[model samples]
Target: MSGAVWDAGRCWRCEADDVPVIWLGPVQTQEHGAGPFAACEPCIRRLEQLVETHHMQADRSA
Candidate 1:
């Protein structure tokens, strides 16, 4: 995992390459054209947190 990929497999947030990369494919994976995605553990956590916070805010606003 540490040496997974040097270029595109980095953390989308912190630019880290010392952990396993997880794909963040589109929800509609069967679409005509799908792309690849990668994220490290910490970046994943941060992204999850932001999503949760955003959803909570949306709910409160509604």
Candidate 2:
């Protein structure tokens, strides 16, 4: 599903028309287990920021 065209209207991030949204989920690898989740670009960035902040806080506490 890499080259599949996603409808922009279904995106939870941008309101732009025909924005190519991708489904990033079910990241099951041999090393890591599977999880139920998906994200758009904006949401992915937000999650990254949140994780960074959480790690920073933990580091400061330690």
TM agreement with the true structure for every prediction: 0.58, 0.46
lDDT of 1 at 15: 66
Q: List the residue pairs that clash in candidate 1.
A: none
lDDT of 2 at 26: 64
Clashing residue pairs, backbone N/CA/C < 3 A, model 2: none
Q: How accurate is candidate 2 locally (lDDT)?
A: 0.60
Candidate 1 error regions (>4 Å): 1-8, 26-35
In TM-score terms, candidate 2 sits at 0.46
Per-residue CA lDDT of candidate 2, range 1-62, in tens?
35644544434444444555555556575876885344556766777799899999999999
Task: Give candidate 2 misplaced runs (Cα > 4 Å).
Answer: 1-35
How many clashes in candidate 2? Answer: 0
Alpha-carbon shift of residue 58 in model 1 (angstroms): 0.8
